[model samples]
Target: VAFAGVMFHLMIGSVYAWSVFTNPIAKQNGWAESSVALAFSIAIFFLGMSAAFMGKVVEKIGPRLTGTIASFLYGTGTIMTGWAIHQNSIWLLYLSYGVIGGLGLGAGYVTPVSTIIKWFPDKRGLATGLAIMGFGFAAMLTGPVAQQLMASVGLEQTFYLLGTFYFVIMLLAAQFIVRPNLALSSITENSISQKKGTRLTRGPELTANQALKTKSFTFLWIM
Candidate 1:
């Protein structure tokens, strides 16, 4: 599950490589730099906004389905961006790569982190760190790979190919990802004594409404 989560994140994190496409797109379309840049900004804004609500969706539907949907939306968005570019329609690019793709990015980003934490309760910090690290690492390779693809196949074709690649990889990875059964009897029994020296404490789990009523939540929001 952890490995699958990492693989999913690696593809979604290609969003970080948006900058690589900016110059090429702007040059090809005779677009002002700011206009071209707005696509990336819009995608990022939607990514954040969607994540806030998608967590509940994931909780309801499970990670596998959420991830599969994410792959579809994201992959389709990427392919649509190619069509948008070919047609010289910036608004379509925003609709495809910004709204649709951003929604997928949000869902894909959250599902794995949440699921992996459940699977590695004993080392949740480590699990989350490793999972998120895939996002950062994605930027490393995608920039160069996208650059090469753009040079070889042109920008539109690059989007088409990369979209297909992401769709397949994320779809396959999603099939192997499942939420851990945190309430399993064996898990509870084994975890009870695992961390002997640590000052472990348990408390009532808070619902969203209850959590919002707390000072900590208010302070964190302010911060």
Candidate 2:
């Protein structure tokens, strides 16, 4: 699950590579850089919005379905971005890359972390951090590749190729993220409770009088 989560993050983190397209899209379409940049902003906006609603959805449907849906939406959106650019339609770009792709991003972003959390209830923080590590490095991993693709094949083709590539990788990764059966619900719960109790209550207790008699308390009284 953690590995799947990493792969999911790696592909979706390509969102961070939006800057690679800004100038190329602007120049190719004869649009302002600001205009081209708006697609990225819109993508991010929908990403937040979709993520807000999709958390509950992930709880209900599970990550596999949600992750598959994300792959479809993102893959389609990326291809549409290429078509939109070829048509010189800014609105289409906004609709495809921004709204549709962002929705995919939201689903992909939540699926792995939530699923991993379920699998590793005790080490949720570590699971979440490990899952998301790919997102941080995605820009470094994908940025230069995108630049090279653009330089070689031109803008629209790059989007098409990348979209196809992302779709395959994300789809493959999504398969590995099966939610745990959870038939051992009671045991899992007990394990989590025991672990938490061990961590929080392991220290020796201090009586109230003994605490008050400490040197720190004396300094406070003087102040």
Candidate 3:
């Protein structure tokens, strides 16, 4: 259930569902369909670009920071997209949903996979599979939700409602999705043991360059 929550939070925020908002935005603005499509393409570009860096950042700073930042970025992006409507500035839409929101998507995308794997080490595959499943279903949920909210509140207000909902849910998931402490302790213990064994048998200190030149090292590198 915990794993499911993580997946739902991350995947539900996916930009795939952004298509649902496109027709309405274009119809209201009297813009061409092609122009609306461009927004999605740009947003996808940002999603891919941000994903490359966000994964490493997650590893370095941890999931909480990554998730928190993602929520803020995504939430602000949604709000800004709505603001773009009020202002009729297409560029603002791209900047918010395409750049900032995509960065959030990338960060949220990776956090749960690694953290959940550690939590359920024996069922890593299942954990990963379930986590991504929510992402796929997010669009299904978003489409109807978008329609209902649009009818009741209109486009501008719909963005605000979705933005606020995603922010709160994602923040909660980030706060609760913690890395297992045992993993760190185990790695530390192993490193200490390696250092202790090396201390007594210090025959010769080979630099990294020197080690690289050795036949055994060369063989291992090939493998």
Candidate 4:
């Protein structure tokens, strides 16, 4: 599950590599750099907004279904971006890459983090760090890959190719993800406590509504 989450996150996180494509896209379509850059900003804005709501959806539906849906939207969005570029319609690009793809990014980003934390109760921090680190480091690899793809196959084709790859990979990863078993989790926790000669302590659990009522939640929301 952890490995699958990391793999899925690695692909979804390539949204950060938008800078690599911005210049190429502008040069190809004779659009202003700032205008092309707005697509990235819009995508990020929707990423945050969708994440706020998608977290609730993930809790209601399992991670597997959520991840699958995210992959579909993200993949379709990427493909639509190719069409937008081919058609030279910036508005289409915004609707495709910004709104649709961003929603997928948010859902995909949260699914793994939430599931991995449950699997690794003994190492929640490390688990989450590893998953998110994939997102953080995605640009390092994707930048070079995108550059090479643009050089070899042109920008529109690059989007098509990448969208196909993301769709297949994310679907495969989602298939392997299942909720952690409560009985198995209890056994694992017991074994870990015995091996470490200490038991882990937990804070009071809160429901979604209860969490919203907290001062920290309110402050974070405002910020």
Candidate 5:
């Protein structure tokens, strides 16, 4: 599951390669670079906003469903990006890449992070770091490849090819991102219980109003 999550992250991380398309898109449309760059900004803005909601969505539907949906949205959005450019419509470009693609980015980005933590409850930090590591390293892998694709096939075609490729890879990766069953979970829980002492202590539960006054909440707010 962790490996699959990593592969999924690597495929979606292509968002960081947006700059590779900026100049080519700008030149093709005779638009100002700043104007074209706004698409990346919008994509990022929606990426953050959509992710906030999609995390909860993943919790309810599981990573496999969310990831599959992400593959479709991102892939279709990329193909739409090509059409947007071909039509020379900046508004359509923003809608395709910024809105649609950003939604996919949010779902794909959060799915692995949240799901991996569940899979490795005893080593949550390590699991999260391992899954997200691919995301962090994605640009280094995607940038040169995107540059070469543009050079060989021109601008729009690159989007088409990459969109198709990402769709397939992400779909396959999503298949392995399943939630572990109760039998396996119980075994891990038993190990953790043995290590932490047979009996576990529970912290006092707090409601929203009560939690607001806690030192931990204050520190979290400050952070």
Candidate 6:
């Protein structure tokens, strides 16, 4: 499940590979590089915007549903984007890749982070790094794969193929994600707490309200 989340995130990072598509898409369609760049920027804008909304949604519905929906939307958007390119409809391209696909990217981004945190309360930093590390390296893998696919299949078919691949991998990841049992969690927490002094606090703990009210928290959030 965690790895699924990682894959979802890595694919989102794969957007960095979009630049590879730019010269090809532009040469084929006669679109300006600046214009294509705008589309990419819009997609990134929506990715961040949609993530803010999806974060709460993930908490409510859980990673499985979130991952499934993200995969479907992202996959569909990629296929639609390919069709849009074939038809030379910039509006359709933006609507599919920039809006719909961006939404999926955002939802998938949060899924694994929340899940990994829940699974490894004691090693949150490690869990977070594990979940997010793929994002940093995604471009390395996706860039060449996308280039090869575009070269062999053409842009339209490449989108279709990549979309299908993302759909399968993301869906599989979501399916394997299981919520850790809270009973086991309590037992572990209790055992760890016993090892500490009379104070039962597990590391540093704070209520959400308390955290939000803190100057450092507010500063960090602002930063």
Instruction: Tell me how many clashing residue pairs each candidate has.
Output: 0, 0, 1, 0, 0, 0
Using Cα atoms with residue i matched to residue i, what is each candidate's TM-score against the true structure?
Answer: 0.92, 0.85, 0.78, 0.91, 0.91, 0.89
Assess candidate 1 and give its TM-score to the true structure: 0.92
Summing lDDT over every window of 10 consecutive residues in candidate 1, give the lowest-scoring window: 185-194
Model 1 spans with C-alpha error above 4 angstroms: 182-189, 192-200, 213-215
Query: Model 1, 1-223: lDDT tens per residue?
Result: 9999999999999999999999899899888778878988888898899889988988899999999999998898898999999999999999999999998899889989888887776788999899899988999889999999998999999999999999999999999778866676356546655647544567889998999999999999999
> Evaluated with TM-score, which candidate comes out highest?
1
C-alpha lDDT (0 to 100) for residue 51 of candidate 5:
94
lDDT of 3: 0.75
User: Residue 157 deviation, candidate 6, in Å?
Assistant: 0.8
User: Residue 50, candidate 1: how far off, in angstroms?
Assistant: 1.4
| Model 6 C-alpha lDDT per residue in residues 1-223, reported as the tens digit of each score | 5676677678767777788888887778888877766667777888788887787887788778988998898888878879888998888878888888888778777777878877776787888788788877888998899889888888999999988888888888888665678898787677767776443454467877787898998899889
Candidate 5's C-alpha runs over 4 A off are 198-223
Clashing pairs in 4: none
RMSD of each: 2.1, 9.1, 7.6, 2.2, 2.2, 2.6
Tens digits of per-residue lDDT for model 3 on 1-223?
3563455455445578877888888989877777877877876677678776776787799878777887888788887888987778788877887777777777777777767776665467888778877877777778887889999999999888888888888877788777778967466555656767752233578876898899988899799
lDDT, candidate 5, 100-119, per-residue tens: 98888898899888888878
Superposition error at 4 for model 2 (Å): 0.4
State candidate 5's TM-score. Answer: 0.91
User: Lowest summed-lDDT stretch of 10 residues in model 6?
Assistant: 195-204
lDDT scores of the candidates, listed in order? 0.89, 0.90, 0.75, 0.91, 0.89, 0.80
